[model samples]
Target: MSAGETVHLTLDEVRALAKAGLAKTGLSPDHVDAVAETMVSGERDGCASHGIYRLLVAASSVKSGVVVPDAVPELSEPSPALVRVDGKGGFAQLPFRLGAPLLAEKARKFGIAAMGLNNVVHFAALWPEVEELTRQGLVALAVTPSHAWVAPAGGTKPVFGTNPIAFGWPRSSGEPFIFDFATSAVARGEIELHRRAGKPVPDDWGYNADGHATTVAEEVLSGAMRTFGGHKGSALAAMVELLGGPLIGDMTSLQSIEADGGRGGSPIGGEFIIAIDPAGFVGDLLAEYMKHAEVMFETITGQGARLPSQRRYEARKKSLVQGVEIPAALMRDIEKLLEES
Candidate 1:
């Protein structure tokens, strides 16, 4: 495929192609549907890092036994407000799907609840989990760590993952306010995409082996990715490591690869989610607070500052009508997988 050549396709097309490819890789029918839906959601929301670009990687992982295809999530609530989900070494979506509603229910009863999903392979974006809780009328926070790729502040050695975190707050009306971000200067998948396209990244994105910042994507991939805000981002990354890793009795960034004997697939990790019901604290006051927030949001937009998740919401609307555009090369790859299936 030539540069800039793309194929415009609807969400259904993307999902059908992903389902066929994943099914061919031996993922169970239900698992295939779950993963495909999550992937299509990413594409719909303009998250290229977690969209169709990840389908082939997921298929490869399943084929190589890195991700167990038919694994089922196990949920156990040892405490009234605490939930533990075992992903059975499978994809994260299945475990999260089973545990999130339970967490929300617990939060509604007890004011707050937390869930930890362990022994899972999380390859997609984290916003979906928190957004689901918000849709259930709860505020939510979700965090997950990954294999080490990001360097700590002032250090060349990579000690942290590009650990992404997401938060959502339910509104009285309209969609929830949501934000998802990577602690690193850029998401690891974005860097990988640039490398694949033979493009140079920003000089501040990552450092070479000698600890010198470089724009060459290949060098950054071979070396260490930098934290977004130097020490501050490094600190947040550490917080995620503790919350999503050891806090959940799961492996930390460095331990992920070790646990898997360096098989080199998606990050094998844990997911930590917290849900809070506004009615628990101040029911009527919460509605008033949202009104104030809406006024502030209007003011912010009036000043031309975009709210978090605005781009994603707009992208979803556009994608629904105009369809998503996938690179010709990527479409060809998906088509090949479909043909094989």
Candidate 2:
């Protein structure tokens, strides 16, 4: 490719590249495939922060011993409606995969179930797990802790992770309603991407060491990411931290970092996922529920509103035909890793 030229790759190509690179880092075949699909989905859905750009960092984490590429998740049940998984210091996806089906089964039988995942590292978007649950006719909510990079309201230093939360509500047909976001003003990875490309972030996105806001991506990263809505978002982040960490017998972002010798990589924490079966409670009422929900949806969209996952769905549709785009520099970096591997 010429200087500054971008590369477009089919979804299969992206997945193959990611799988090969991740496998070379010593991840087991299943683990490599899981991570590759997650990463490629990010690119296909236009979530650049969590997409192929993350592969290098993931590789680094494996090398740094922060992630056990070949580790397997262990599942256990503490109650009829509670499912738990220990990731054994591996990626979060495997644990979710190990536990989700059990949770779904219990939820179907008991109306609701919770899956607690500990000793895991989450470096990808949270929607995939919850969205998959929705496909099984369940509503789902998932939260995961990350590195402490967001400040509580009125604070200088960061005390919370970007702390993403994802929720999915299954529709009667077609795509489900799914939404995922970081409680921080912006995702931490977006800032890192800006820093990598030598760009500035918005002032509201973060603070410097002195607690003053700044646009310099590197400075923001050096200090703290900001809460999206002042105290409100901070509170949500705190909730996620407690749910994904302490409540799940894992460390909060700060605690994880302190325990891990202050290493900078994807966080070692936990995930909390809740699956609720609407049919168990409503049964035939579900159709009525859908009717009411669709009425509200149609009313909102009539006024030019849109559903939460619409953008992602549109992006996915386009990517199916046009392929995923990789920045020239990033492609070169991945190629170098492939060569090294």
TM-score of model 1 vs. true structure: 0.94
List model 2 lDDT by residue over 56-157, tens digit each: 978999999999988889999988899999999999888888788899999998999999999998788899888889999899999987888889998869
What C-alpha lDDT do the candidate models reach, one value each?
A: 0.87, 0.88
Task: Output the worst ten-in-a-row residue range by lDDT, candidate 1.
Answer: 257-266
Q: What tens digits encode model 1's per-residue C-alpha lDDT throughout 199-292?
A: 9999999999889988999888778999988799999999999999998899899898677676788889898998999778987788777788
Q: After superposition on all CA atoms, what RMSD does each candidate show versus the true structure?
A: 1.9, 2.1
| lDDT for predicted candidate 1 compared with the true structure | 0.87
Please state the error at residue 25 of candidate 2 in Å.
0.7
Candidate 2: C-alpha RMSD after superposition = 2.1
Clashes in each model (backbone N, CA, C under 3 Å)? 0, 0
